[model samples]
Target: MINNLFSAVSAAAAQEHFDELLRRPGLRIERIVSQGQASPTGFWYDQPQGEWVVLLSGSAGLRLAHEPSERVLSPGDFVEIPAHCRHRVEWTDTSAPTVWLAVHFDAV
Candidate 1:
């Protein structure tokens, strides 16, 4: 049963924040669990997957590597993490569920 459609959360696109939404074969979706007030500190993964994160609820900080840019995301803001791109979090709300959606992929 799908009621309260108005209460359902949705984001059209990651305007100005995401690099590019690449959709193709061999791509996979990964689970990102950032419970409480914790985040990865400017790290890079040894893989070919780009992460596109959308802030489902609460607030969080997304810092880009080699770039002097820090984005504080609310409930609807989204971001695209490039493949092997190093990054870190500047801050996150301590009293809220910081839910996020991450999509990963490999470049051909």
Candidate 2:
């Protein structure tokens, strides 16, 4: 089967959209679409699995709990988040939808 990652995106959505692409033992992949969305104040994500995410289109701001400043991400930018590493999405492009490809897997 063939799939297009850019298809079926809704920029007018009320919240960030997540689509699971594939799942296997100890691994999963998903696509995330964000448009002018951000993490709720005082909220952070601490996941049991490690994540490797890439910005496919548009832009965003991401912050790691241990970092002093947010990292500005543009298309093609990627980040590797270790398991249990707290992080948050600070902001996303308002004029266009931001596309992200995320792979989650058990940490070695």
TM-score of each: 0.62, 0.97
Candidate 1, residue 77: Cα displacement in angstroms equals 0.9
Task: Flag regions of model 2 displaced more than 4 Å.
Answer: none
lDDT digits (tens) for residues 1-108 of candidate 1: 654312423233222122222455866543343434444454534446776777767688777776788788898898878877877777665554455666776654
The whole-model lDDT of each prediction reads 0.59, 0.97
Q: Candidate 1: which stretches are off by over 4 Å?
A: 1-25, 31-35, 40-47
The lDDT, on a scale of 0 to 1, for candidate 2 is 0.97
- Residue-level lDDT of model 2, residues 1-108, one tens digit each, is 789999998776789999999999999999999999999999999999999999999899999999999999999999999999999999999999999999999999
- Best-fitting candidate, measured by lDDT? 2
* Clash totals, every prediction: 1, 0
By summed lDDT, which 10 consecutive residues of candidate 1 come out lowest? Answer: 12-21
